[model samples]
Target: MTERIWKIGTRGSLLAMTQTRMVQELLAEIGVRSEAVILHTRGDQLKDKPLWKFGGKAVFVTEFEEKILSGEIDMAVHSAKDMPAKTPEGLVIGACLPRENPADVLVVRRGNDFFGGGGKEKRGEKKADPASGPRIGTSSLRREMQLREQFGLENVSPLRGNVPTRLEKLRTGQYDGVILAAAGLARLELDHEPDLVYHSMDAARYLPAAGQGIIAVECRKGGATEALLRHLNDRRTEVELAAERGFMYGIAAGCHEPVAAHAVLGEDGTLRMRVMKYGNGRCRYFSGEAPESRCALLAEELAGQVLAALRPAEEEEDHRTGSRRKDG
Candidate 1:
């Protein structure tokens, strides 16, 4: 009898390859033969433009998802954050590895001052002044908005590239600092660098993208492939991500929406979620907690809170626009 081999499709970046290799090793452990098929996505090829300008996060996963749908690959591995709020009609996230650190990090040049407060006190260093607008590099609208509104980063600049490229630019003095996901840095082991300083942003202060730290294996809706993927699912991660993604989907927002939601499992088997929506130079926050078994409902309730909070502001804006048009 011959062993059946599965094909895993993924973006061809170093980080993507690293993550794919991790999955590959897991499959190998169970005597399942699989090969990684590196696909150069529009997101990878169009490194010059910011993600939103390139038509949002779908650019990163659409090709891979299409490949899966076309049966060119058995499955596609992706950073969960790159997935759209709604899964495409023919496919779904069949499995997800255990979640990693979901917090964002501020990577700054040596001796640069941008963030201030508690972390510095622990280091016995003076807290950096909040008003010193360090030139921060990031393409994420969520990160950019948080930096400008919360941290007073007046010099936010557009930066697009993989981790190594962005770090090199930071090292060469192109940016005073850069924002990156702590999970990716930890996965790449770039969290500890002699040339850079890392600050793990507190989740209470900085909400992460929906499904930010998860590795999702997506596949078509049914059959042997989906069955094979069921073995890879981490139940806890699925529940948590369900809540976070539900918050996103309920609000009809995607990666480009300057919205972030995160869910954390509590010691008592409950789930607590935080959601933030940024607009008009400010942010509205909503939170809810529920039994782990009811995460989906909890997420919907949180989304409702966020939407309710935004109604007044949105209506005000609509009224102002209508009045302006009438005058014109």
Candidate 2:
């Protein structure tokens, strides 16, 4: 009997290719041979445009999903973070590989002060003013707001491109610092660049994108492809991802919305999650934890809690403003 050969679909970007290769290797270990098929997605064509300006994160996975459904590829491998909250009908995430370090990291220009605001200090201590901080670059609105609110960094600019391009920009002095996923730098072996200094941000303070650092293999609802992909699923990663995606679904978050969520499975079998949402010129945080089996429900519950809390505050503010207007 001959082993089945699978065609794995992935984007052409270096990071995407790297992740795809990892999936291929995992399959090979299980005696399942596979070949990589590079697909140029709308996200790739519009690299220069901000994701929010056009199709949100959907642009990244749309073509690949189409290919899978059309049977052009047996499976699609993607960075889980790129996937949206809802899967198209007839498609399902067959597996989520073990996640990498989900924390965000700061890569600073070699000769510049590593921290944006001169150096790290107590929250309210004498520190370098925001005006004098080095310019930091990132595309995430969540990161931008967190930087300003938590680190007092006000000079963040929009940065687009893959990991290498972003690093090249920093190397050429296009910006003094850039924030990137630690897992990406590690996967590409770019974490040790001598020209840059690395600082791991605290996850509680710097919430990452939902499903960050995870590699996912998606397939149609039920078939040989999905059955084969079942071998690749990591239970812990799937549970954490379920919680994160459930929260995203609950909130109806689009790529443009300044929203971020991170979930982790602890040794005690508890799945804990932290989520952040920016609205009306302010940021709000929500958190919850539950057993792995109930992770998704826990996430949805937290989402409801956040919405319930926000509506009244918004109504009261509107009422106060209206009353002041009438008195004046």
Could you give candidate 1's per-residue lDDT for residues 1-328 as a string of tens digits? 9778999998888889989998888888878999999999888888888888878999999998889988999999999999988888989889999999999998877766445445633322322564344678888888888766666566778898889899999999898888899989988889999978898888777889899889999999989888888888998899888898899999888667889988988779999888999865587788889999889899888888888888888999999999999999
**TM-score per model over all chains:** 0.93, 0.91
lDDT of 2 by residue, 1-328 (tens): 9767899999898999999999999889988889999998888888787888888888889899999999999889988888999899999999999999998998887677557454455221224676556778898888888888877677788899999999999889888888899999999999998878888899877899998889989999898888988998998999888889999999888878888899989999998889998866778999988988788789999889878877888788899999999999
The whole-model C-alpha lDDT of candidate 2 against the native structure comes to 0.86
Instruction: Highest TM-score: give the candidate number.
Output: 1
Best by lDDT: 2
lDDT, each prediction = 0.85, 0.86
Per-residue lDDT, model 2, residue 300, is 90
